[model samples]
Each structure stands twice: as structure tokens, then as C-alpha cells.
Target: MPFTIKCPLDNLYGMHVFSRLPLHEAKVRYLVEEKVPSMHAMIELRSGEKVRIHFVHPAPPSPTENDESTERDAELVIVARSVADSDEPVIVTGDLNDVAWSPTTRLFRKISGLLDPRVGRGFYSTFHADYRLLRWPLDHLFHSHHFTLTSITRLPSIGSDHFPLLTRVVFAPSQGQDQEPLRPDGDDRSWAQDIAQSKNANKQDVP
Candidate 1:
């Protein structure tokens, strides 16, 4: 399932598919149809288990423009909520341009009820490869509670500004019940709504 946003949109940042699974067995469907330059893929495995995977490259903050990051975050929350509310498992991975500890990230987790595999683990910062002291975990992989972390590692640099992250997770629906789910409080919901309704919520270029 190759995904490409055509001419009028920035075509440089499209998502490509490279799955080893037999194409005939797995069915792929797109979940997001918004103007935002992001991609969401819902795959039904041969076993009939559904998994939603989203690749996002949200807009980075700029000094000249007002911070629309909140709006972008809100849009992502909406997408995540849709998936989380379903029985299918979800995994969202991308360069959010925000730290794991940031308020936006927390709100995302709360609204989506997704688990951060790095919660008890160490920070796997991927940005500013050359700067030792100014790095934070900008690239992230958030999953539903139905999955368990098998291993997560920050791969060596491929001459990019950010290092790649490699994670191995297994779907175990039985273990989901044991995991504590994150829920959004009233204030968080209100904040998300406000952001989503902002006048500057027009589509912007995603990194």
C-alpha cells in the first residue's frame, strides 16, 4: 500500500509500503482523508486481527508563525481516538517534533489510551545527532495496550539529523487487560476541543 499526496500538496513527504506479508492475505485501508500531510494505514492480518499504523510528520514550531502545533496535535488526537475507540490495535510512529514529556504528547496518550513503551525505559532521543546536550526523544512509537514491548533500540546514524528507532512489539490481547489505560480528564478534553476549533487550524506543511 504505497501512499502519495499529489502535485498540489508537498509530494516529497509521502509514505511508502514495504511489508513482507503476502499482499493477498493482508488488506490495507486508509483511515485519514484530511489535508494534513500524514498517512494512516489499517491492515487486517491473515488471522483477521486489525492493526492501525499512522505515520505523522507534524509541523515544527516556527518563530514567525503562531504555534499551530496544538492544532496539529488535536488533529492527531482525533485520529487516535477513532482507532482507540475500536477493537483494533493501533501503533502511531513519527517525528512529532515534540518531546515525550510535553503536554501535547501527554494529551495524545490520554485521548488515545495508547501506551508509551519507553515509560519505564530510558529516553531514546533521536534529534540533533551532533548535539550531545540538546537532544530529546522527538521520534516516537506509541502503541495500544494490546501490544507488549519486546525490544526498542535507537539505531546508529545514517548521516541524518535524527537517528532511526527500531522497535519490536508483539500483539497480546490477553495482556491488555492487565495494563492500566490512560484517560483524558475534563480539562484535557476541553483543551483539545479548543485547539481543534482554533481559527488558525488550517492545513499547514508537515515536516
Candidate 2:
């Protein structure tokens, strides 16, 4: 499981990120529709370096909600492309809706060139807090190669269905120098375009 599972949106307009660091720059970027957006924040560390963070919370596909993964997939594709074009220590994370190992999430990882710390680590599943057996890792955090993972773990539930997650990383530009980013294949490109065009980009076959 590249890492998450699908479900209905109990609170469609819910999700937030907090930081104690000084924000050098920040903005909300829309995906598909203005109401559905992601937060792009640039933080200035004490070392004088800046890390670009993209916090996303695309709605999930369910019988009563999106029903189809079109908008959700397209949102991820849009963010992935934007993150790909950026030249900085980026961290793209949030409740990605789909599972990590799924084709859609894998494509997002490839297109954005981010690295999943959970690649060889445990799942640390975070959904369905009330039922441990039914939980899955629906929430994710993927960062660029510029930083080294200090720690990542799932926090106990705070009365929410999904468990909160906490992670820490230290910037080490040297670590990124020797790392390679993930790249998408032809089929991945075609599928991404099809999904994006089906909604906000250009009109084409639906994925």
C-alpha cells in the first residue's frame, strides 16, 4: 500500500497545518475549483534557508460525494506539476485521499519528484481511529531530497476519525546533492493530462 485508503468526507471543508517558525511567504492555491485549495507556505529557518511547503486536502471520492476520483486526481496532478517546477526544499503533504501504493499517488510522487519517508518504513496507518482493524494510512507527507528525516510517527487520536501525524527533518543540502528524484513514464503523463483536462485544464477523455 503506497499508503492510504478511500472514504466519505465527514467534513468536506476541513484540514489545517500549523507551524511555530516564521513564515517568509504564504498563499492559498486553488485546485480545480477556488473552494478546493491547497496552502503553499515558505518558512525561513534560523539558518537562513527557506523550505517550501504545500499542504493539500483534496476531497475524497465517495458515493455521496465526488463519486468519481476525477477532481481529486486532478487536484493532485495540478499540485504535483507545480511542485515539480519549483526549485526549493519542498514538502507536499496532507490527506491525499488515495492510497500511497495506488497508481494515482505513485504518479503524483513521480511527477513531483518528492521522496516518501515511508518507502521502507512501517505504514503508520492513520484512519478510522475508532476501529484499529479498519485503519489505513490515508494521510501523507512527502518532501524533497534537501532534508533528512529525523522522525515520523502517528499520534494518538484526539477524538477525530483520523490520527494526527508528527514529523521532524533537518535540512542538509549535501544530502539532496546525491539523491535522484522520481520521474513519471509516458502512460503516467497521458493519464495525468487526461484527468486534468477532464476537469480544469483542457477537455479530453476522462480517466
- Choose the strongest candidate by TM-score: 2
How much does candidate 1 score in TM-score? 0.79
Candidate 2 stretches greater than 4 Å from native:
1-11, 202-207
Candidate 1: segments with Cα more than 4 A from true spot? 1-12, 22-36, 64-68, 199-207
User: Each model's TM-score?
Assistant: 0.79, 0.87
| Model 2 RMSD vs true structure | 6.5
Q: Measure candidate 1: CA RMSD.
A: 4.9
Sliding window of 10 residues with minimal summed lDDT for model 1? 24-33
lDDT of 2 by residue, 35-118 (tens): 666667687787888898777788788987687888888888877877777778888888988887888899989988888888
lDDT of 2 at 45: 81
Instruction: Output the TM-score of candidate 2.
Output: 0.87
Every candidate's lDDT? 0.68, 0.76
Error of 2 at 204 (Å): 19
